[model samples]
Target: MRFIKFFFIVLGFSFLQSCSNPSLYQSKHYVFGTIVDISIYGEDEKKAEKVTKAVLEEFTRLHNSLHAWEKSDLTDLNESISKNKPYKNASSELIEIIKNARELERASNHLFNPAIGELINYWGFHQNEFNSMHPNQLKIKNLVARGPSLDQLHISGSTIKSTNPHVKIDLGGYAKGYALDQASKIIHEHHIKNALINIGGNIMAIGQHGNKPWRVGIQDPRGAQAIAKVDLLDGWAIGTSGDYQRYFINDGKRYCHLIHPFTGYPVQGVYSATVLIEPSQNAGTLSDVLSKPLFISKKEDRKDIAKKLRIYHYLIIEDKHISMTKAMADKIQFLNPNTQKNNQIEITL
Candidate 1:
């Protein structure tokens, strides 16, 4: 469920003049098994470091709690649920994440499932080894036949239990967005004016960089070029999910890490999907989770699903075509004009 981190391009910023800009402080930290880069503008160096340090500490706390496979609080909770044992005193963070997961699971008709940990393991995605090796048909069939759903989990107050024995929850999909939201809160509490927090590829921009919108680039799924660029004003969050990030080619076929819960395999039909929305809407989780709807939801139902999920704008790239919401079409500038295929479809709903 790991998303490919998209690269952000700052249009008006220059790297050579960064040192002369004392109001800007930037640093990169290793958290959540990825490099998180944070930049703060309009703040003194000392104050920026203080704000960054506080956010980093928060990230450390969340990294230990929401990890999918690692031995952490979440793993402990998952182990308990797998054995039909309920954890009476789960953390509030875990409870909140699970509550959101359940809501999204129902909204997408189970297309977005956190209880597909077993299925993820079957495909060897639980480990870091994402190679040409795939699970056997029998294993896939068995898991698909008895796959678990987030609805099967029971959450009452602080207590949590799993009614299905095979249910194992993983929050890797929305974990980064959740982290960003928490970090944004900490940043705002510090009164930081302009800041950009990029966890892996998920980005949330607060305020503006020198009276200008924060510029971001969406990576081309088929190559290294940036296919689209966007300007993010205040309180904007954007993320991209691509099949190119974690994948393997076997017998001339490529397999990605994003598994479709219904089919128990990597989802096709989309090479990359980028979503933009207000972080305040859902604490930045919508940008992360909603980016994959083009691949997860049916074509006819995508607009309705996007509306239900509160996605403000989106751009989806396929093998030989592209599709975008009307909002995205107005905002996105295709860096490589040739990449905008002739069969482009506009979603207006």
Candidate 2:
């Protein structure tokens, strides 16, 4: 006999049902300021629960280690660079994250820098309080002066040193994707053939649903409704970054959470960016890190960069216009554009 249940809870809800003989499908959410929704497709409920717990635990561990606002975390490492002291042998996990971040910085021509933590704080995006005050010109100049390039980081095995004492590292751009990658590995090792992991805005899909691709909806930046839907077959990952997720309004102007490291101001022109990639141990970390830079780049320059990196399947929504890369346009199939009354333009990637 197959058993399934669906229940709605105020804080978190679960939807579970059995389709194939023994295989079950379940979706649930975990809340921590933001909610992480996870969907599992498998036969063993006990095993699925265990895998889910492991994935969540890994997320918690990474959050505690990398969150800059947490005073108890190793944030002191960001300030001790002037002493010529290397960060005390960091965990192998953190070391790998740092290495990947540095590589991304180089790949994006310093557009995707991890050494912008101090700048992030100065802009007040890290604070939960929504304030629309922009930093002054002098403050912006000082912060930019203190910024460190990826080359300034020296790493040997698990040890890391910073050439600039003012350089502080923030993993907000890539940590969730890295965590999802690690969690997916854990699930696969447990022999779970199908699963979906969503950490905040980062999403990963493995296997299929009843021989059909898992369906993911890309939310509209202007509202809560989904504007586009993409199918994930044989496992893929998708990530979306937008100004709509977090913002504050002041004097009739809205300030978004994503700040431009160069100007110490919020990034403009583009409203949202969504990236799709094959999910592996790294999932879509590279894509997530590159999205912001791609969003702010000129149309021609963005196309050139995407082609150089061999990223053809991505979407950018800017100035209320939608554009898709030729590579991405050929693969993505849109389901519902008129689902809601909101205005959304869809383009083939």
Candidate 3:
């Protein structure tokens, strides 16, 4: 569930010579076993650090409370599936997240089930490290058969109970986006106008740098020297999931970290998928969870999923072609196709 972290280096002192006094704010390994980098333009360095630290602390608190992999967090909820147990009440924050997860599960027809902790671990994506071993078909089938449905979860007020004994929830896919949204709220509350928050490959841009939008580069899956750049106009969160990021090559076949819930195996046919979503829209989690399924799904199903979820913009890179959502094609600027000899084409969704 962890996306590869790409560090953007701003090189040379010459680039800094123009700013009157640019304040750089950065916090690494903050939460969810990922590095978070925050850069605020034209803000006091001391004040920026204080705000960043506070936000990071809040994110960490949330992670400790909700992370299923952590045994301590599992104590807070009722684990009994056969009999409903009214355990300790859940925090408001946890309630909100569970609500959002439920909504996403319904919207995606359980394609984005958060209760797939066992499946994720079976595939070894939960370790936050690159997995070189590919699970056998029999193992995948067994894991999928034991996976729980989202409907088994019961939320009564602040309390939650599971109807399945083996149903373990993993918030890795949506937690980062949720943290970004929360951090953005904190920054806004502090009256910060312009900033950039990058948690792994998930990035959120707030306000603007003069008239220019935040420029983000999508890494090439084929291990090219340069990246495909995308320009963002106001505040939006962009996340990219790629099979090329954390994968294993075995017997000339590549196995990716992103596992299909139904098949319980790595999805193929697409190298990468990038999703752009407005902050006002709750599409970040949806995009993260749906990227793999959309890539492996048939063309008609892909279109149907996009329409059903109302995705704003997306780019799908397959072995031989590139497909773009209608919304993405309208705003995206493809730069320098000549830089690479490979064929590049755009399809309207």
Candidate 4:
């Protein structure tokens, strides 16, 4: 049944309903380079269908506007800005995304940088074509020394200009979460009380599964299965970043797409990071972007930065141990497969 898919591979939400009932309605679309799944409950079939349509339409709109690698609205904006065009036009939504990205870059202490698009392409992440070869040391050193950041971006009215000629914007990390938040808005606007949206395993939920809260599986970085599960109440979002998702191995070393802005290399030390935050327009985006900093930050600074960003619940898993905030430890149940690993530790913050 679909519940098995949710509980196992996709890290999706498993409803409390029976498989034979089939009362809940589900719709799936391929957009934003991930499977966008919407499940709606507590509404008639027709209304649920309509709500799903609205949500998918919103995703489509966002995919067209925000995609970095594709030939879309974002591509045009990036091209114009790179060419030093005079005060080019952009949608208000795009402007808001850039603005939020800049704020997040500062809030995360410049760890989560969207302005490293050149470095990203250099590593072949932009093409999904990691050849199991690292970039030349000179190139890496030059990029690192240059240190492009969103601070170089200046937005005014509907136009944006980059103060640093090397600055290039790629919103891949933040755009999916933003799109999911928009989908949630559409679901709520339709008054669909019980709904769950999972975009490439970045999940957000509203209402409940009948009388029970939605249960989500957090995937293990070591394998495809979920090592833990967390119950999510209404208006909560969770996003996870893991090296296992997009990486290539060279010799015995592993390289991933989540690059460290300062070093211009893939981040290490944490295999996976999961964050749970209160819902908002930026909640999903924050969840997605915050995980990188939490995973890559100094051990002592993780909690401080998390709290500074208003993220009360988060988990960081390394090779030998798992550490999490109390808010997360309280809500998560480790699956039996991970019960005796002896590395599950909790922190109070």
Q: What is the C-alpha lDDT of each candidate?
A: 0.79, 0.67, 0.67, 0.77
Tens digits of lDDT, candidate 1, 22-52: 7778898889877798989888889999999
Please give the lDDT score at residue 123 for candidate 3: 68
TM-scores of the models, in the given order? 0.93, 0.85, 0.86, 0.92
Distance (Å) between predicted and true CA of 216, model 4? 0.3
For model 2, what is the error of residue 294's alpha carbon versus the real structure, in angstroms, after optimal superposition? 1.2
> Which prediction has the highest TM-score against the true structure?
1
Q: Give candidate 2's error at residue 155 in angstroms.
A: 1.9
Better of 2 and 3 by lDDT: 3
Superposed on all Cα atoms, the candidates' RMSDs to the truth, in angstroms, are 2.3, 6.3, 3.5, 3.7
Model 1's alpha-carbon lDDT is 0.79
Q: Show model 2 residue runs off by greater than 4 Å.
A: 1-33, 72-74, 82-84, 335-349
- Write one digit per residue (lDDT tens) for candidate 2, span 1-349: 1111111111111223333335654545653335676667654778778888887787777777777667624476675665768877777877777777887777666767778877787766665564667458798888887767667988787677888877777777787677777777887888888777777767777786556666667776665556666776565777766877676666666666667767767776677877778655566575467676676566667777666655657888776577777666666654455532333556543
Rank by lDDT, highest first.
1, 4, 3, 2
Instruction: Order the numbered candidates by TM-score, best leading.
Output: 1, 4, 3, 2
How high is the lDDT of residue 142 in model 4?
Answer: 93
Query: lDDT score of model 4?
Result: 0.77
Error of 2 at 302 (Å): 0.5
- For candidate 4, write residues 246-349 as lDDT tens digits: 77777778787888888888887788889998766667777678887887787888878887777889988887778888878888888865444667575766
Candidate 3 displacement at residue 255 in angstroms:
2.1
